[model samples]
Target: MRKFIAKTVEEMPPSGIRKFFDIASEMKDIISLSVGEPDFVTPWNVREAAIASIERGYTHYTSNHGNPALRRLIARYLRERYGTSYDWKTQTIVTVGASEALDLAFRAVIEPGDEVLVPAPSYVSYMPGVAFAGGVAVPIETKECDGFTVTAQALEAAVTPKTKAIILPYPNNPTGAVMTKEQLAAIVPVIEGSDLFVISDEIYSELTYGGRHCSIASFAEMYPRTVVINGFSKAFAMTGFRLGYAAGSEEMIAAMVKIHQYFMLCAPTASQHAGEEALRHELDTDFAQVNKMVSDYNRRRTFVYNAFKKMGLSCFEPRGAFYVFPNISGMGMTSEEFCHKLIHEKHVACVPGTAFGAAGEGFMRCSYASSMDNLKEALKRIAEFVDECRK
Candidate 1:
């Protein structure tokens, strides 16, 4: 059996994020913050749309590219919001989730031994996805001092002739870091010089605070070479629907659709109908529901940041997404050790920073997407645990 297993599949480690989540699930009275899911239910309008779709017998498969209407809406939404344009008919693909869109992008572009630059402490799926696509995942460490952004210097240093593309996980998962337009511009020259393409994971795009998210695809020079990945999961709280999309050059999307057609056939038809409704309602009402959720998340983000500060932990103030990455280095334990003991001692679960990448060694990621009461209780327990560690 062991000999029959593909070496790559067998050797790859399981997700570090899920390991603690599984452990926490087995324990009683645990306030698990290990997952990055939105606590809110999918907006009523979106859910109702799915119901209507099912009633209308939309249970069958959609076109391999997705529902034409949904693809058009996605293209419009991206262009109106980010100043990027795409031809829905030829430059878009609907995937199982942003996760699949990511995988498709990797499989579409990568050849054996090609390198994909991943910013460290990024979403866990990235490196593994690259590996599964037979590409080398080269991690470029983003620093706490630089607000967890990939600087031009670091990106340039990591690139070699083998490098084919880079994954831009802004509104980053563990760190909640976002790149401003100016920050994105600084790296354009390097990307242009290397002739490398980009996979911009903007799953948390709508969850940004302080300012709007600036997509790299909005840059004229980069737009042609960038695949922008996003979906309904984060903003609309539609994770269970398992729908996401990718938009880019016609060539890139054609390649992705070729792979997606054989592998997934299409995203769920009912989900695509729901996604279309979500976007239509958002556009009509100016994103009223999504804005409300973002506002609530902002409140939680502040609470979490302040709680960490009061507990004497060094935490970067996150401006996007719902997670906070706080440095737990002073606790005299490794990230895994600290997380393990905290969950056992306080019954409050968080993901170890090392789960994200090697650069996350001294940190831990806590999602603020829980209810206010849950967050309040979790923070109180965490503070007590911090004091106990100090003693």
Candidate 2:
């Protein structure tokens, strides 16, 4: 039975993030700041729309590319928000969250021996996604001194003849780093005049604190080669809905759709209906509720960043998303050891930065997505643990 398993599937490393989570789950009195999903419930209107869709008998399979109404609304959302345009009918394919969209995009474009450049301290999925598509995952490490933003020099140095794509995850997950227009512009020359595709995962686009999110696809040169991966989970508090879509050139999207058609058939019928309502109802109204959620997250973000500084931990102030990566090297322990001890001894849980990449060592990712009360208590426990470890 063991020999029957595929080598790739067997050899892949188990998720380091999940290892701590599983331990914390069985423990008592643990304050978890490891999970990344928003603690907020879905907006009432979106939930109601899904209920209505079910009542109206929208439970059957939809078109392989997803509902036209949802696709068109997504296109409009992109245009209004990012000032980018794509053919709703041919250039967008709604899948089961951005996770599936990423897989489909990689499978559609990658071949054996191709190389996909991924920035380090990234979401844990990108590397495995590339490998699952029979492509090599090349990690270009970004540092805290540089604010974790990838530059053209680093990107160009990593590119080889086999380079086929690049995974750009901004408003980044563990680091919570956001790339501004100028930052993105600096990398344009490296991508321009090349055949490399840009898989820009902007799932956290709406949660930026400094300014509006900038899409790589907004640039003229990058647009033709960029596949913008976005979803309802992060922005609308719809994680369980598992709804996301990809936008790209007609040819690329068509290829992805073919893979999606056979692999997933279609995204959930009710989720598609709910997604449309999210855009048409909440988003069209200037995102009143969504804006409120963002405000709350900002408050938590500030509190957590200040708390880390007060504790003498060196951490970059995150400008987007709901995480803070605090350097833990001074604690004289590996990130995994620190996290394990913190949870077991202090009853607080945070993900080790090494969960993201080897470059993330000496750091720990603490999500501020929990309530203020929870965050305050967790920080207090963490402070006690830090002090105890100091001596």
Candidate 3:
């Protein structure tokens, strides 16, 4: 059986984030903050749209590209919200989730032995996806002092003739770091100079704080080479619906759709209907529900940042997304050791930083997407645990 399995599939380890989550699940009274899911239910209007779709017998498969109406709305939403333009008919695709859209991007662009630059401490799926696509995943480490942004110097240094693309995981998972337009501009010279394509994951775009989210695709030079991957999961709290989309040039999207049509056929019809409604309602009401959720997340973000600061932990204040990456290096333990002790001793669960990438070795990620009461109690226990560690 071992010999029959592909070496790549057999050698891969299970997700580091999920291991602790599974452990915490079996324990009593554990407050798990490892997963990056939104706490809110899908907005009522979105869910109602899905129900109406089902009632209308729209349960069958949609076009391989997704529902035409949904694709149009996605194009409009991206253009209006992030200044990215795509032709819905030829340059967009509906995927199972941003996860699948990412996979499709890799498969479409990568040939055997091609290299894809991934910023370190990025989403866990990235390196593996590149590997499965027969590409090398070259990690470029982003520093905490720089807000975990990929600098122009770093991007320039990482590129080689073999490099085919780079994954821009802004509003980054595990770190919650976001790049401002100016920061993004600094790297544009490098990208324009190279043949490298861009895969921008903006799933957390709507949750940004202190500023609006900026897409690399908004750059005239980058727009043609960038595949912007986003979805309703993070903002609309529709993770269970498992829908996402990718927009790029017609050529790239056509190649991706070729692969996606054979593999996924299409995204869920009912979910597409729901997504259309989500975007439509957002546009019509000026993102009232989404803004409400973002406001609540901002409150939690402030509370968590202050809590960590009071504990004397060095935490980078997050500008986007709901997670905080706090340096636990001063605790004199490895990231896993710190998380293990904290969870076992305090019954509060969070992820080890090393789970993200080697650059995350001295940190740990804590999601602030939980209820305020839960966050308050968890922070209290975490404070006590930190004091005990010092002693």
Candidate 4:
């Protein structure tokens, strides 16, 4: 018998989050905090728009770049929210989701053996997408001492001759780390003269705390070399809608569209209609609701952070997004070990930090996207587990 394997497909491991779900599925009365998805339903207006579009027979495949109305709306939304603008006709393209946008961005620029610098414990897609596109993923660990944000010093140290791009994940997934405008400014000088481009994932841009999101695209010099990937999933709780988009220099965006067309002809037709309302008319009202969700999550963050802090766990306070990435190194177990023991022993399920990347060892990511009742209950179980660990 011959072994069949391809370097690309074989190298990719199973999803870190999926493993927890699989294990939790078999357990009775499990409380899972491993989810990275939003728990909210799509807003009423957005859903109604999609339903109306479908009723009107707008079910056919749209233009490869997406419906023109949606593209225009996306461009408008970017300008309104992030102070970054793209030409709808020439610079924006909608895709299946931010996942597909990430895939397209990596495929657009990465080639065999090229090095891609990624700040660690990012959203699960970055390194894998790069690797899948035949690029090497070089993980640069961001320290909790610095709120898990990448500094210019870190970015400069990670780059080399083979480095072609950096995947900047601000309002980060697992860590909830956010870079200030000043913090982002620090890295611009490092890449000023390099041929490196930036792939900025701002999916969590709207979920940010009071401070507005700063786009790398706002930097005129960087605009030509940066591709911005964003979506309705995180911001509008439109996860199941599977609508996302990317904007960049026309040349790069066109290349991404070419690849997108050959793979996914267009995003869901009804989604494009819903996306139009989201970008143009509904965002302000919908984002108010999004902000309310963030406020609720912030309250839970305070509650959970205190729980870990009271237990003498080293937890960095997250400034944005809805996760609490507590450093569990003091617990004297690897993140995976701690997660498994907690789930099996105490019926609480949270993801190990190492699942995100090697640099994430000894940490655990907990999503506070659940109700306070569930969250408080999970923490009580965790307290009991910690007491046992200490024994």
Give the best candidate by lDDT: 1
Per-candidate clash tally: 0, 0, 0, 0
Candidate 1 lDDT by residue in tens digits, 1-391: 8999888899999999999999999999999999999999898888999999999888998899999999999999998888898999999999998999999999999999999999999999999999999999999999999999999999999999899999999999999999999999999999999999999999999999999999999999999999999999999999999999999999999999999989889998889999999999998888999999999999999999999999999999998999999999999999999999999999999999999999999999999999999999999999999999999
| Model 4 bad stretches (over 4 Å) | 284-286
RMSD (Å) of each candidate, 1 decimal: 0.7, 0.8, 0.7, 1.4
For model 2, residues 1-391, the per-residue Cα lDDT tens digits are 9899878789989887788788889989988999898999999889999999999988999999999999999999999989999999999999999999999989988999999999999999999889889999999999999999898888999999999999999999899999999999999888875578999999999999979999999999999999999999998999999999999999999999999888799999999999999998865689888899999999999999999999999989999888999999999999999998999898898999999999999999999999999999999999989999997
- C-alpha TM-score for every candidate: 0.99, 0.99, 0.99, 0.97
Instruction: State each model's CA lDDT, in order.
Output: 0.95, 0.93, 0.94, 0.88
Colliding pairs, model 2: none
lDDT score, candidate 2, position 35: 87
Q: Give the C-alpha lDDT of model 3.
A: 0.94
lDDT of 3 by residue, 350-389 (tens): 9998888898899999999999999999999999998998
